[model samples]
Target: MADDRKVALDAALKKIEKNFGKGSIMKLGEKADQKISTIPSGSLALDVA
Candidate 1:
């Protein structure tokens, strides 16, 4: 799965660099895990599909 996903991400990153500029791609990787884990219990919807 990781190998397949890396191929997909490589394609995506090239598109990002072409359309949005190289800086955007760098910024996205730099901030990928910078989100807050502040989900409120009971306020989130579960997806089964």
Candidate 2:
């Protein structure tokens, strides 16, 4: 049930990090608002999306 979902979520996160490189994904509450950083992706649409 919930455990199964957690396992799947963790696996998915790992896969994303593997493909996109580490620090590309963040779990809920894993990031602190005060420490957040932003940079332009060069396209407004891409950045917004």
Candidate 3:
């Protein structure tokens, strides 16, 4: 289950990098943190749901 999550996250990150252009590679936790930090708190509930 964890492996599947890692693979999915890698694929999603690759797609994001492709669209945004590459710089430094981030660990999964860092990426998640960055996303969560940037999103508005009100919309975070909608995102998780």
TM-score winner: 2
Query: Looking at candidate 1, what is the lDDT of residue 31?
Result: 50
Evaluated against the true structure, the overall lDDT of model 2 is 0.87
User: Which residue ranges in model 2 land beyond 4 Å of their true spot?
Assistant: 32-49
Sorted on lDDT, best first, the list reads 2, 3, 1
* lDDT string, candidate 2, 1-49, tens digits: 9999999999999999999987788877786335657999999999998
Candidate 3's error at 43, in angstroms? Answer: 40
TM-score of 2: 0.59
- In angstroms, give how far residue 41 of model 1 lies from its true place: 44
Off by over 4 Å in 3: 28-49
Residue-by-residue lDDT tens digits, candidate 3, 1-49:
9999999998988988898867446665654334334555688678686
lDDT of 1 by residue, 1-49 (tens): 9999999988998999899866566634375535445645653464221
Rank by TM-score (best first)? 2, 3, 1
User: What would the C-alpha RMSD of candidate 2 be, to one decimal place?
Assistant: 6.5
Predictions in order: lDDT = 0.69, 0.87, 0.72
Clashing pairs in 3: none
